[model samples]
Target: MSPESLRGWVKRDRIDRGEGGPGELTSAEREELTRLRRQNAEQRKTIEILKKAAAFFARDSDR
Candidate 1:
């Protein structure tokens, strides 16, 4: 099975065992994930700004 499929099976098995299951992210893991998500949001905002700037320059050239 593919890695994705394997991961899914593992998650399902964990849930079946009545463990924390998919909610098992530790304090450190959760903090890191939150930081990464925030960083990704910032990167997305930067990309959006760059796209708008590029479009504005392109429109100016077409004038």
Candidate 2:
């Protein structure tokens, strides 16, 4: 495909034709995405802590 066509294809495939995919994010949307990502990271950390605690207790009980 030509460069122009390839760019169009990439935009369509990766960003869904600028319909709010990776290549397109407004300032407000970017902030929201950052906040959501932080929330997700915090949640994952909490889950890991809980899992470790559970494993520790389970192991102690097995002895």
Strongest candidate by TM-score: 1
Q: How well does candidate 2 match the true structure, expressed as C-alpha RMSD?
A: 7.2
For model 2, residues 2-58, the per-residue Cα lDDT tens digits are 999998776656554346555586556668999999999999999999999999999
Q: Each candidate's lDDT (Cα)?
A: 0.82, 0.80
Q: For candidate 1, lDDT tens digit of each residue in 1-63? A: 799999977876665566654567655566899999999999999999999999999999998
**TM-scores of the models, in the given order?**
0.61, 0.59
CA deviation > 4 Å runs, candidate 1? 1-22
Give me the displacement of residue 30 in model 2, in angstroms: 0.4
